[model samples]
Target: MKLSRPLVLLAVGAVVALALLAGIAYIFKLPPFREKGEIKAGEVCSSLGSSSNAVDALTKVLPEESSYSFDENIDLRTDVTDTNFESSCFVAGGGKQLLVAKARLMEDESATSWTQWVKGTASNEVSIQSLTPFTAGDTAVSSSRFAAVFVPCTSAGKAPGGQYNLSVSTELKQEGNTNDAAARDELIKLAKNAASYAHVKAKCDMAPNLGGTS
Candidate 1:
């Protein structure tokens, strides 16, 4: 059968259009977005160590008259097992004692970071802070002292496609008894403890999720 040139061209055009449509459909049907990993509850506390030692260390550095209180628990959760936790403590006789901590985890091995501020305290409050992305031994501590407005997240990572974990801790002090060096030391020690605790919790929760196999 001899087909006219214009008719053959038209037929060729239709076939090309159909093929393009099929390709588009296949791309969309393949799930362009990967499913977010799942994070199970109760994973946050699986390997949390005792905070008592840290608290006791802080007590040694604080003034004899100063009183302290600590609270530790999971605060937020996502469907993918990414979690956040907070550990706070308050000191009396120096305004309101406040400590805050937070963390996040992902199923991917990629790095990530997040920052949060201390709440329920004075707008202008003294803060002591520390953070660890990998190990507690590999930490960065601040030298000079000053009032902080917001805590910042510098670096972060994620796992493959499973759950991830994170943690944050903070200690806040109000201006009082400037001559009491011991009080300041105690506050700083407490803040360090909070940070350490948060780091440990994050590692424990996200350990199983590493490599996304879990």
Candidate 2:
């Protein structure tokens, strides 16, 4: 059959249109888009370690005798509520990626000077299934692990009494296969020292008491 020039043009246009539609479909078939959030597990760990080092350097600048420690097994929990607070960040090699999680404390209704809005907001950020609850002595611990870039915190000006206290506790596991009470005690002591140093730094960062009798 003999084809006219107009027919050839029409066929070509149809082929082009089909190709364009296929390209568009392929683009739409991609995985659901998500915005990238800050630091991975490895990065967070490095940052936390770096922060500790920075504190040490700062202490050297001071005239007072300074001795600080770092807690390897830190437990974070909330005093205002029965629920515990925990977080962990780690990076896996191979095809697996890194994950960083930040768990915030929840407020109990019975607790005094508690902020409901802040608690609600923090709860929303928590991944419930990932959270693991544990207890040490009389204290309750809650922890969660995730892949994140930044540590989440309560929104400014939303906390109760314009203050939010985060308590971090740490314990040391056995060095080898054997779990000894003495080793555990030693680890706790080191962790307590670290926690004490961290508390001082936190207080300074939050509010510096400049006006006091020297």
Candidate 3:
């Protein structure tokens, strides 16, 4: 049918509008849309090794109305197995993967470079002072966008070593510098909470250092 010019334009506009809505839905992980991928309770700590995570549900850590809540969906892209697990979680904001947390088991007593905290304790590099919050753990680190904890996991890990280490990493995309200090401190706190969560779930031998909650 040969429609009038205005009518043709109106139809085109409707299609474009629908496409825009679809794009928004596809880009942002809107609530009630991807119910199957929802992050249930107690999932955040173990999210480093599982598809389910606590990021979206960590109101205590990320805040209920934080800008991160408006970011893209949670992506759990890792290689985990039934016995051993090594996984990472990321907030895929604007196509940039900002690591939120990664949990893994390691037997490398001399392993370093995983995080600034690990590197600093391993060596006395001059720039080691840049490790923002040095009180995260026995070996840990923190920044506006990073926090990691390496704890004794004699009972937690199923790996070969009778005694090993449990590592939990946390970071986020830095939106601004106005609150960098507070952000670094908060990340350090998050890392502590995450370490505790994993310790209990994984049946670790000892509690995390975490600089005694500050």
lDDT of 3: 0.51
Candidate 1 Cα misplacement greater than 4 A, ranges: 1-52, 63-67, 70-73, 76-80, 91-95, 98-139, 143-167, 175-192, 199-214
Candidate 3 residue-pair clash tally: 2
User: All candidates' lDDT scores?
Assistant: 0.35, 0.31, 0.51
- Per-model TM-score versus the true fold: 0.37, 0.24, 0.51
**Winner by lDDT between candidate 2 and candidate 1:** 1
lDDT of 1 by residue, 4-62 (tens): 99999999999999888777766654223223222222221221223454444334433
Ranking by TM-score: 3, 1, 2
lDDT of 3 by residue, 1-214 (tens): 7999999999999999988887787667453243233334443434432223344223333422213322222223222222243544455433444335556655535435455335433222332335653655457766555667787655434444455566776665423333657666666666666666555555455555555542
User: What lDDT tens digits, residue by residue, belong to model 2 across residues 1-214?
Assistant: 9889999999999999988877775675422222222222333232133444423322222112112222232345433322344433222222233222222333222222222222232323442223332322112222232111111123235455433433333221112222343323322332233333433433312321112111
Q: What is the lDDT of candidate 1?
A: 0.35
lDDT of 1 at 39: 21
**Cα deviation of 212, candidate 1, in Å:** 27
The C-alpha stretches of model 3 lying farther than 4 A from their native spots are 1-83, 94-99, 108-129, 155-159, 176-178, 211-214
